[model samples]
Target: MHGSTPIRASRTLKKSHANFYRAFHDYFVTHLPSSSLHPDSRSSSGPHHQLPRSASKPHTPGEGPSPAPLLGGTRDTTVVRIPLRSAKHHFGVSVSRGTRPYNEDTYQAGVIEVPAFAKPRPLNLTRAPANSPLEAYRAKQREEQEKDSGDGEGTSAESASGDPQVFYFGVFDGHGGSECSDYLRETLHETIEETARKYDLVSTLKGKPQTAAIVSSSSSKEAAKDTAGSATEPAKGSMPEPSISKASTLQNNLLNSWKTTVGGYFRRFKPTAFASPPETPTTSTVLTHAFLQEDLSFLLAQLRLSTHDTDPVRSDAPLNANDSLYSPTHFPSSDPQVKKSFKGGSTASIALLSTPTPTPFWHPSTPSTLYTAHCGDTRILLSRVSDGAAVPLTTNHHPSTPSESERLRRWAASFVTDSFGEERMSGLANTRAFGDMSSKRMGVSAEPEIRRIDLNPSEYAFMVLVSDGVTGSVGDQEIVDLVKESKTPEIGAREVVGFANEVSVEGDNATALVVRLGGWERRSEGGGGGMGTREAREWRKREAVDPRGRMT
Candidate 1:
């Protein structure tokens, strides 16, 4: 009787939700601003908005069945161009608890605006002697700027490529408990921004060109290398001089100083665990520090909370009501049964989008770039616009991988294959993750593998980040096909998660986060279903499950 009550309640809630959404959709259409309305809708003045002619008009007997409506059953292709990072409509997220008792997965999608690191003044080397290497380098730099400007190749600092906006999307899949994933969803991005700001400030103070305007592409790396190389090489039309190497040494010192500053920031948090930061820091280094540092901090916090040996109340002492020691929530537990249940681990898949400036209404001046930092088996895939093909942005970190096995050997840890033929390191499938303090000492790392992709709108349509629940049941190409054929990102995300849950035999929690990119809505001449043939076959053979987790 109790089980039936929940089932009945679920049906009622589903019906109510459907009615609410229908009413909301009607109200939104009636209240939409004229400027925001479709060209077809603008002609109608009444609160009752007219459907597109294709959907409203009856098909004539011989009119070739009339034109079918676009993907979402309307001809309106008008999309508001907001900052991609903060635009809720442009991003879609869906999660299903599946057959799990409770969900341990967490996700985050948002923008980080780094105003402090947006702009930096150019270093002034004019005061140096004419014969000095610094003066020669400055002259050559000015010459290159003139050449670029004259060739109409100058890039504006105010362009999207130079914008201090960072779009962050992350999925954390937890095992054992949700505490570790929850902690990361709350703190990781903020830590990254703080570290980046400090890195930029120190770079400026040490006379190294700041990275604010150059974080867009590999071009930034080339620019920085050129700047450093100029210090050692003789400037064009300048004779070889003894001071060139001296200037180069000065540049190296400047690089070290900035690295030192970043290192100091991490040391303040975990002085013993993080004794040294990378000498040459980049985007990858920043992600690595944030992941490892946060993991250590989280483990320490869990240890303190779970290993409490102090008495909750002292009979001899008069306790104030305001004191946490007297409160049930904060009172320490002296029970010997208190175990380290909070030492759960979570996989992290993070993507940072550096968008290119859109000019003349939706046409980008340059291609956008994506940087992904990932650990464990959570996957990040890019769907190409040309043929709707899947492009992998991260490889899974499993104990079965050759590189992972070798690394485990070095750390005195090895994968153990169970009777079921599943390879595990310290009883965990993934070799790297955010927590699992016990497994951490046995070579379970929190270090993420970083990857960069240059997203050309003509080639790439969208990107999806999915936890292992979805990846385990669905193929990469199948995921791309599902999102590609959907009407909108929200529907696409839901379909991805729903399909995973439907086909999954184990019924693990499933999550999908889809971010629409420059090439969104542009379909290929060839259709989509061809790539997802295998998944389609599997789906057909499986018993269909209803939304409420019952066989249909």
Candidate 2:
């Protein structure tokens, strides 16, 4: 009876949601001001002078059949600095971790299944403010780089020759106005990359490759437990082959992985944190060594520096997070309260590409990198154009994953539960995301499950990244099809966004960014565009567009 009730309620919920979408789609936007096309102020940031399109003429790397509507609207914020250490340790390690604004009302959705060949990566890195000096430097470098790599030289298609090419693209799906998505749009990729570099994950992965350790640890732990009994011997009829790496008794669930590594990163350990203003404890060098006994010497050393302790709540200052979004920390400051008086957040996915490394048994052609990160349903879809089929790139993280929920179940240990004494379950809320910090214990995960993947140059057409606005109502497969089917990725992207918006309507701010091989063209000489006669600028200023341009 209880199960039946939930099933009925789910159906009703779906019906209501469908109705809402239908109504929203039918209602054409009214009062769509140029300012609506432009941006309003931000809770955490200042306004921008102009959009990217305004600063430079777009030299589309990939072109397609049509140029649909362009998504506009944005806000800018101060440059964010993510610890280089964290990013490297947690490559493809999920959460584009941040100090998210604490809030309630929020919305997000999308699908993600990492490319089989590629491991999951936290698609996040630190970002510079829209117009900061660092931003200026980076932008200048890109212009020079693009000119050298993309100028009329016929080799545009393979611009990424052997050397690492920094590519930028993002899908910012906004719900309550384009604020959150726009913030992400302006700052997502740079943040992800910077964060990734910090952790120096390439070294971390090599030091403790997740796979070999799991196989060895499980074999050791379970073998000890089963020595007396419960060891299901190999079927006499089918003897097991002699492979050095045997699939042990461990369940292929994410939780088991936690018992060894992941859980430690999330929880507070006795690290040597630097002292605050209050009476700081002076730690003698000898005492610190004892604390470092458990391969956590580095961590303990850090703690001593800061009066370290577990329980993030007890900290004098909050766990270090993005500088701009610094509301959640426990520290008291003279800094004026951030004017951003709104409650909102976003579900984001981030990743980093790495150089190939050698593995014990497997001969991988590409870098065995980590994608430690969290995300909304907004997924990362990877494709290898040579095969002509889109491939899954990372596991879709949601409240639905039993393993993810299990981690939370353990976390809820001290809290009271049902009459039957079962631990309370906060499973339905997404297990990981960026903006849903208010729902941290329930709706979000502070830690991200870093997955690994290899990038193979031989078989990739590039990746297509989008937010829920683009994929929620529209099928994920359809978006991939659009990208692959189109002649070039730019048109493919524009068409994909247009179609997605057409299906979901204005309420869902949809955006698509494609970073792929080329068919790039030089910027159109800024002049009277759109055929010989009616100038493009005059047409917009006077609503006097001529249909004659459509003729030729």
Candidate 3:
């Protein structure tokens, strides 16, 4: 009888697991908005074209139901699979078109390889040249590459070991159409890597205190004089250093140091210097430049095509119509005029995790750095396993913000309010986005706000990047909590998307990308799955109104 009890317990556990999944499947199919399930129900002409029935299977209400399979069971066919090259890094992505006829959300995740010759110059008190940092870095990289190829040596940094690797993840939310997002999905990361190689090629101030500041050659004399005059007192007219408390954590100390170093190296120097201090190239600057340049390029290509239709010379030119830039059929057109013009825009939230190679220049105990570049409302959140805290790394860029509103006002851009009372800049919700040629002239810029964080593996578990579809409906902490108890990152991403689909009234296209960091697989005590999720609460409320429809 004792042996039989053990067998019966194992069977019961399996049955319960199966039942839970069955219930989820039933709820998902039943609650799915009718517009998504029935193609004819949606308008034939609109920004969102109806997806083919073959794109996804729609389970009609009251029809025969079955347990959803693991991978193939999802309705949307737009799920992105990670490449085998990036498999070493644990990550997962889930993308689906909910109530919309087509999915405009897209994501990219993989490893980016920085050039082996890329290394930051050693820190020195002496002022550097006035040349652009990007130009100088490129010239040096070219010379170093030639020398390395001849001698078969790596980076010039003394005792340097291997090349640094960057784990790159990005999610793009498209409005107007998916063309812009699709183009960004294919090209944005490449542009970032190219820009990083030219501008942020080196790891600056590694293995040393970040107190040293790089100064301009012209301000060297005044800077030295000010430094000699004051240990505690400020010079006649100079920016004062921001105070740092001893009680602050190491992370906070590093952050303050970075701000002091980058904000103004000549903090104690006199006023009447040249114009302003030369900008120092860093990851943030690199990302900002990449976003702006990419946006400009996308807009230029779109505008050129839009005007080329009326240009007789362009029509008769020998250019290849199949070329990516010239091809009108490359992406679905959202324009009503059927012109070859590309009319779409997208919001981007990108996170790059940079880990130094095993080199003497970098300390063995040094933590990886996370650099996030954000434009528009897509979100990036970091989950700390130590205390189960959710930290948002990017701020949403909307016209409603004071700074954004003021900036738009300066450009003489008019604002419009949607039926939902949401303010928009020239008919677009986001004040910053990519490839909206029309809005570009109306103060809609692609300049991304950048944030830097020193990632402590033991303290941080994972990072999640989601499109506005998920963020619009789920709270940051709730999203992190939902993933906390998942068995794997892939399952967590699916659950987040599923929950967002259920909560959203318009059925927006949803996407979630989870990257497992050092603290992944480690969970804070007393944290796991339960019935306390937002979806569960909503379900309970619905059940209260219809007791007969309740699930056992």
Q: Best-fitting candidate, measured by TM-score?
A: 1
The regions of model 1 sitting more than 4 angstroms off are 1-89, 114-164, 201-280, 309-341, 358-366, 526-552
> Model 3 misses residue 412 by how many Å?
3.8
Error of 3 at 94 (Å): 0.5
Computed on alpha carbons, the lDDT of every model, listed in order, comes to 0.56, 0.33, 0.57
Residue-wise C-alpha lDDT for candidate 1, range 1-552, written one tens digit per residue: 775665566566655644432211100001122334343554465435333332222222231111111121233333222223233346788999899999989998765432211122334554888899878876665665446333212222221123323467899999988877887787777667654543331211112322332221112345334222222222343222333244334334433532343332222222111113223334444555566656656765666655443445433345353233344233333221223347578999998765322121112323555667788999999877666678897778887777777766656445689887989877889887887777765567676666655555445777899999999888898888888777777888998998888777788989999887767757343345334455563554355544344344
Best by lDDT: 3
Q: Residue pairs in steric clash, candidate 1?
A: none
After superposing candidate 2, which stretches have Cα over 4 Å from the reference?
1-163, 172-338, 354-372, 410-429, 505-507, 517-552
| Predicted structure 1: lDDT | 0.56
Q: What's the CA RMSD of model 3 in angstroms?
A: 22.4
Each prediction's Cα RMSD?
Answer: 16.3, 23.4, 22.4
Looking at model 2, which ten-residue stretch has the lowest summed lDDT?
A: 23-32
